[model samples]
Target: MTSLFAQEIRLSKRHEDIVSQRLMLLQQMENKLGDQNKEKTPQMQRAETALQRNLSLLKDIEAAEKSLQTQNHPVPPPEVASLETLYWASVEEYIPKWEQFLLGRAPYPIGVENPNEAEATIQKEVRQ
Candidate 1:
């Protein structure tokens, strides 16, 4: 009976060791993941800031072009009117697309599942 109890105690120690190793590994993984997530936060913020800057610059350019057209054709020149009409049409067509591009994606794509691959692709293009 004593031998049987000793064997059971040994088995329990082995099981405890296995559980301890698993817990240690899990803690290490959590720490690594936390570090990675921290690294990605700043990268995501930069990407978002860049995208906003690009969109703002594009809007500014478009507004300047419209202003120039208005100045050059105070009396509604046919060319200016045509240009204005086309510009607005283009804006109407593109605003939804741009909104979708800006607001529709996961921030990080390197390690996690990214639902915003499309936006990420646009961000990549803008960076290039």
Candidate 2:
């Protein structure tokens, strides 16, 4: 264990790593579940349960980190906090609510165009 600040960074990293693991797990499980050639074994069910539990734990850890940031005087390392927030948020859109693993739809985060908003922005030429 480390200081709160250090832990923040560590947990942030952990969260990211877990997200990747979980997503990969989800995909793997999805394939297993879909394959009609094989029967669903008890081991497969156990693995699914384990993944959900781990995801829940990670979500709890993130919530605790946010609370620490709010309560503490100093902002807990700025770079760590900012990056953690970004990583957590980026994954948030994908991870399903507890017991709600809808593998059919993966909310992969990506950049998208908002033409209306882009048009609203005043360019230098328009300003002049």
For residues 1-128, what per-residue lDDT tens digits would candidate 2 score against the true structure? 56998999999999999999999999998997777435656668888999999999999999999889888866578767766766576457435532143554534323224555434432322333
What stretches of model 2 exceed 4 Å from their correct place? 1-40, 74-128
Local lDDT at 69 for model 2: 81
Best by lDDT: 1
Q: Clashes in each model (backbone N, CA, C under 3 Å)?
A: 1, 0
The top-ranked prediction according to TM-score is: 1
Residue pairs in clash, model 2? none
The parts of candidate 1 lying over 4 Å away from their true place are 71-128
For all predicted structures, in order, the TM-scores are: 0.47, 0.27
